[model samples]
Target: MRDFLPADKARRERVLAVIRERYRAHGFDEIETPVMEEHGRLHAGIGGDNEKLAYNILKRGLDAEAIRAAAEDPAQLTDLGLRYDLTVPLARFYATHRGVLPTVFRAIQIAPVWRAERPQKGRYRQFVQCDIDIIGDASDRAEAELVVATLDTLDALGLEGGIVRINDRRALDFMLDTFGFPVDERPGVLITIDKLDKIGPEGVVAELAERGAAPEAVEAFRAFLMRPQTLEFHPYGERQIRKALPEGAPDDIVAHLAGIGEAVAAARPSTGSGAT
Candidate 1:
């Protein structure tokens, strides 16, 4: 819905060049992934509720059985969808080409991705993602390297004075469970939380209500997100979380998220990217 004139394109190219040069200097090889991915793979528990924003491709070349299946379930009518991000297709690419890639592959992918989010702010349906993925490296060093590389790239763009925030996936899940979100609705709740900065607490509450979340759970989570003062973290986490967690939780209340602090301390440091 928007057009980039010559000035915009030139500025964009300059930004891209800085990022690409930095990625290469950090020893990341440029790679490409498909713009469209199989719907099944895109929906396979990645991208959280953002998966719901996928633009599904309708099934073509339908045989009689295929038509019947489509009639029974609308989801059966689609086989592929425009990818919401490069991560999923990159995963598919790695699986297909792992034999040729290095034992530890560091890749830089900059490309357009599509997502069907509500039109707001600068978040259009289409945007570019500059990604650095380190595959086959699980020592947590890879994540550290990524943060450093990203910071250097931003510095290359002459950007300064920004804060860095880290999200731990395991810790996020624990917090959601601690807030009493149903197991089935937790993913959507996580997605909503991701948007909290952009949409604010009230907006998140409205969206969760629209998504059919239990009223009490939504209110509890809103309050949780707005909690004040420092939490007294334990092996599992703060004592308050134990009170919120469901009966028969899979892990001990204080036993979860035990290693996160150590991991944060262990990550590679950046001159400017450290939290204040």
Candidate 2:
């Protein structure tokens, strides 16, 4: 974390003001959450591997022996923790206030969060995060609205060349089904796929094989990955989305994301001209 001088603080606040105004204009109401949450809730396997980065807050009045014993297991002594991200706390907030909230809640959260990290030039142990979430809406329109709002915010901030990469779990499941991967194994397979950028395609296939993934499924995925890639830029459109994916991608999933792309393009014409 770094201290902000008067000028810097003012400039930061100005930018945040724009973000808040844009988000509110899009119908997302802002809400505040405490910086701390119960330790058990923070580490209940919901935050994934990021849970390891949480800054635990020790319970008051713990003696020396108790502190040492709790070193190996933080949950033993830490009753609360500094939030690593906004998601967990938002979940708790919704659960506690669901009755009073509207049928569908559009939330805007802008706050500082802490994480234990090997800090470097741009990475920090603490930083401000801006998030917008729509709760209780399961329709594809929800997804479209989110994308459109984000792109609109980027436009509002005068930040050029912003793009979003859509990742739909439904589409992923359909692709996995086509490859013949079993239901129980999809999670592990997805974990490996998440590492594709860091490990490369060959490394991903190797790790998948090592994990005992279905051989036929692995071979099919490998072939899909090995297929010749075009160096062409695909503009935002339904056909373009299908062209970027492997064969047998579900029509509904493609249409769902295509709808989002179209909505974003309509909101900001120049900003929607890229491929992922």
Candidate 3:
């Protein structure tokens, strides 16, 4: 097994202390949950090949009798699995603890999550996921708040050159419709386009073509994705620029962001708290 020396452990603990302090000041309550959970609920909300990566567990006693009866049955050996991400488990937790939780429950969970996958530098089969999420509100304000808080956390962590790339799934869908992509194919298209950063424009085009997208549609998608970030918001209306932001933006975007900034400033805990 891998082990960290005393000095390394102290440094890690110090970083965690800074993160906890910053998150708590912003009204995020810390909560803990089990590392292993039922696979069904985890895959229900976020369905993808990502689900297959979860580390399935086979406890000896619970399934031992069934396995013994079958002698060589593969199915009897595995049932429960490790959590893939914090979000799904958080959703299940919310549903279970709805009555006890507040109207807007802001939580910070820092825990190790396991995934069955090939690992390399910076990527691990088992790693820690630090997430702070606010649940129960369907408003865009909640999303904006979450984003801002994430930025705050990053700033606290002393990380650099980090940019919080924000995109609304709805907005992307709207853009897809605008460019004549079918609604049914939009998710696939977005998933491909999302890889634009990792893979170049040509890579995206090739993937789209492989998915049976017509050349013209693929060209159009390439054009749309390549468009410069010139989006502007005027929240109040066309005439009055609401705090010099986009018109269709959620009313609380600016306010929540400002609040996060204020909270960060008040804490003045560290230089690495803000997001890129």
Listed per candidate, the RMSD to the true structure in angstroms reads 5.4, 3.1, 5.9
Please, what is the TM-score per model? 0.76, 0.84, 0.72
Best by lDDT: 2
lDDT of 3 by residue, 1-276 (tens): 146799998998998998898888778999998887875675563735457687777756765567787667654566678898887778778899989999999989999887776756666787788988887776646655665566666677877633454454544554565566776776677777877887899898899989876667777877755666544321223223232332354544444444434444344444433321
Q: Candidate 1: give its CA RMSD in angstroms.
A: 5.4
Score candidate 1 by lDDT: 0.73
When 1 and 2 are scored with TM-score, the better candidate is 2
lDDT of each: 0.73, 0.85, 0.67
- Mind giving the per-residue lDDT tens digits that candidate 1 earns over 1-276? 368999999999989998999999989999987788888999998778678899999877878888786786878888999988888989999999999999999998999888887887777988888788899886545665676677677777888844445466665676667667789887777777788887898899889999999788888877765666454322223344445343344554334332332343345344444321
Rank the candidate models, highest lDDT first.
2, 1, 3
Superposed Cα deviation of residue 32, candidate 1 (Å): 0.6
Candidate 1: clashing pairs of residues = 235-254, 236-254, 236-255, 236-256
- lDDT: which is higher, 1 or 2? 2
Cα displacement (angstroms), candidate 3, residue 3, comes to 4.0
Query: Residue 193 of model 1: what lDDT?
Result: 75
- Backbone Cα, N, C clashes tallied per candidate: 4, 0, 16
How displaced is residue 270 in candidate 2, in Å?
A: 6.4
Q: Pick the candidate with the highest TM-score.
A: 2
CA deviation > 4 Å runs, candidate 2: 68-72, 178-185, 188-192, 195-226, 231-236, 269-276
User: Which 10 consecutive positions of candidate 3 have the poorest summed lDDT?
Assistant: 233-242
